[model samples]
Target: MMRFVQGKTALLVSAIMTAMLLTACDGDDGQMGSKGDSGVDGASGNNGLSALVSVTPLAVGHAQCAFGGQQIDTGLDTNSNGVLEMSEVDSNQTQTICNVTQNTLAVDLVGRYQSGVYGLSAAEIVDYHPLSQSAFVVNAQSGKVDVLDLSTLTQTAVQDEAGYSLNNIAKKTELNISVDTGLTLLGAVNSVSVSGNLLAAAVERGDALGNATQGNGIVAFYRLSESALPVYLSFVEVGALPDNVTFSPDGSVLLVAGEGEPNSAYDVDPEGSVALIAIEGGVPATTATVIDFKDFNIGGTRNSELNPLIKINGPGASVAQDLEPEYISVSADSQFAYVSLQENNAIAVIDIATATVKRIIALGLKDFGLDANKIDASDKDDAINLQAYEGVYGMYQPDTIASYRWNNTDFIVTANEGDARDYDGFSEEARAEDLNLDPNHPQFAAAQDKTQLGRLKVTTSMGDENNDGLMDKIVAYGGRSFSIWTAEGQQVFDSGSDFERITAALLAMNFNNNNDENKGDSRSDDKGPEPEALAIGQIGSHTYAFIGLERTGGFMIYDITNPFAVSFVDYVRNRNFDADFAIDTDTGEVEGDASLAGDLGPEGMKFIASQYSPTGLPLLLIGNEVSGTTVVYQLRLQ
Candidate 1:
């Protein structure tokens, strides 16, 4: 709620044709501007009212604001190093930048988490390599992988991660090539991965996400050699939905994690798999061996509804669901793969070399599948989907599952849902209907009769009493409530009187944010991802969860120095909403909220912590999805 008017140094300049032709506005102070020009839906709202300042101004000192809101917001310290203040003055006439010194307020359009290298195009980049500026980002709906120049906005290259190439590469001739005629000699690929100088991705015929069908998921390769543009090569077809591709720390081998289904909605389960493409100095075959998602965590419970329904679709079709393989994080040594099975609320530990699912950890156990189920499903305008309605259709509650490492061996956070507050929700009676029992869709219209889960039944610390830092170890905070856990999964924290975790799940935060606030940790060669977990929780001295209340509640800063008793700092902004945070270790400068970039549903993100940059600052890559549009945010901490 920090509000401030930028020094529109550019608005002081001349006019743009787009803004001027809006039938000129009278100099009335209270005028709301012509009743939203009625020409095109969203066309030509850009013409400026011709302010005298320069338009492309740089961020300067922060300014304090007395009021703020949609039009003129208020509340918030404008001088925080990472904060950007915001305020909209008269249509087409407002400050574009507000850099205050108070340490709190922030600007809406400010490039806090600017678009770095976008991964899915639909989502921002997840993990990025600072050394090569190469990253892993997906344009899921497009079934495309984009390699970007984080420094530059333009895309460096796009690879097809689903084309056929990596299957059985060890014995294929197209894969075994001389040291000279590199893999890049192949056609535009499907998927790609990179490490240090070695880069690789897979290829699959037809966009895998576009269909509920299956194809030969290929693996391709490319290396940035010492020569100018040294190498661009092909790996080979690996497997179906070879979802996540990764590399060994030494850049010796390439690993691809399969999501199993090309499209979950359509239910094409082509053996959830993985593939290990040999590095002939980083060359892959025209076809690679197809392993499976099972090699990870038994590939989660198979989608029952998708079995008979999954199939192939050419183009213009609904992108299937459940096929998402949320993430694949590797240990510092690349010995283990921490794979997340978001759909089933499970995290599997896999042995990289053996391609084995070593351990499958059940997360959020105290909560039932119907606990988070939605009951409101009225097709009418503003109609709500029924909750138990999902159960009646053979569905359980779904979790977002985008958790990642915050700072320790067992510490990582995943989102339970991408958008908890997007809908109005269904009634208890309307939700109880089981989807599985009604697979025939007989009473699809008679939804009012089914029973619902009754407000996320399950109470605080209901599960994980032992607190082992594992999912099952944590206790429930009570009644479909959102709670925080220790690395060992102990229910160490829950918002007191907080509405619930179902709606407002704590989002991205560095456990170190307030921890290192007073004693900043100097980034060292041995330093790991910051451990202090950062989250979007209740603000003020309140000891309760916000759980996404309709009203704004400000962000809470926690100094988790003592895991047993984490301390709360102060409230910054309440409702830029589902806020995400990232900080530059070297500069001590921070950036957050970049939420508006991904529509309102900004959820699931990854930050790249690779080798030092030539300029010395390590890089951070981020990605998120909202309202169908996937946006990327890439920014150097400094």
Candidate 2:
């Protein structure tokens, strides 16, 4: 047994020594036998799984931000498909990105097109067509629409004959609204709107003397072409005196604000209405749905619902005849329209889908006694003295209204420009001193001084709440500011004395100057730096409001991103403050260096987004009624 054990051990040692010698000759024991199939391949290791990212554009009414922004999504490819699907996106990794974190928003004049003629309604309203790169200006003096080519437009600043810098733009052509149309358009073009290759012009019927008539107006459609004249299409009959016309976002509807103002004699008053024209395949209907204000008449169903603050004091006129639709702003979804009733100090809400009046919201009075709502109440004061008086309130009679969406909610912006019932038959405007005030009135002493509130224009229609012989409250004409209201007419934000304060700070030399004449403090008694034209635009991730000062000759910029916390951004005026400008009211002739006057009396404004801008930058187009010019301003970030 000992011999057998020793022989086996010796054999085992020999086998181990042989194996060791073979492994050393092959140097590392080959490669460990080729990676065996290992049963079913263990599911192929999931293709090494990848992490992915995606970016998409957010719209205006996004939940994350008021202004549009970028949405970034990131996730791991859990399914090994190499895609960050919505379902696979990691909510924790999702982010909302906006423009430059910190940037200065500004605007600079790019170009301006002048009409040579001045002191007339030569350029009242302006609208731009991106495809044609053209601006349609309401040349009321010629009763036509002047189309200016913006395709070849360069910076307005150029070398003049004397080698001095001058700004100018070329006129492309004039559209004859009277000719070629079967209807007799004897009146001037009041407004123009452009959307996708289509141009709409509001044409009213007039007498042979060019005076507005009680007949229905028309909205003429034209095809805008880049290389050809605007081809006239059919016309849709709206109510009398269509003051403003607008196209819906989807281009499927056209809204018209029928002013229906009475004649000078006040005997032929017509009912104010809103017309909704349906467009099928780009062609407007022959007739429109004229939504009247009859439901809000004195004895109508909605009469009791009307707010007491609404001014319905028109002589022998019902609510239907007194509520003039001065301007119309449609919601982003085109489902609703808000019409400004300037004379009535109210706004009519219309349901576009149903073509009916939803409600009428009366803009209440703005108390001047409050510190945030003071005004320069006297043109004869010889200085900018913004004062607040006890018992003094102002009617927010807005002129131009604009709508925008913020944080999934709707807001309406307005230029509280004010208006009065001044006619041969009736006039409600009176100077504060001219009004007979009660002895107990708080501002009676100040009302007797022309240098104080005496010269300020106030409406005699109000203030006499008890219908006594003497006045009680001193109600002024305009709020002298701009305001922001919710869709239901809840006052959210008001500029208050910002307009007057800003003008006084930046343009003290020309404070409250008039459009026709550079007379400082002349308009203070009426409407100090009347904020007439307003346009809201989106620059980067911020929404800005541009307000045009009709009296002071400039525009104001406010960052309205957080409407409740609006901040003043900037103010721009291209006018020559040193130059003396005047116009002959009777002769309609300029008596000063109109060329050096720059832009005056901004009556209409249009904002062009960067994507649709001719210069590939965001732009703002303004129509100056007094200067008869259309100025282009480029919005930028630095």
- Which model scores highest in lDDT? 2
List lDDT for all candidates, in order.
Answer: 0.33, 0.81
lDDT tens string, model 1, 34-79? Answer: 7764433332343223312123333111112111112222222223
Say which candidate scores most in TM-score: 2
| RMSD of each candidate relative to the true structure | 21.9, 19.8
Quote each prediction's TM-score. 0.44, 0.82
Worst 10 residues of 2 by lDDT: 157-166
lDDT of 2 at 476: 85
Q: In angstroms, how far off is 285's CA in candidate 2?
A: 1.1
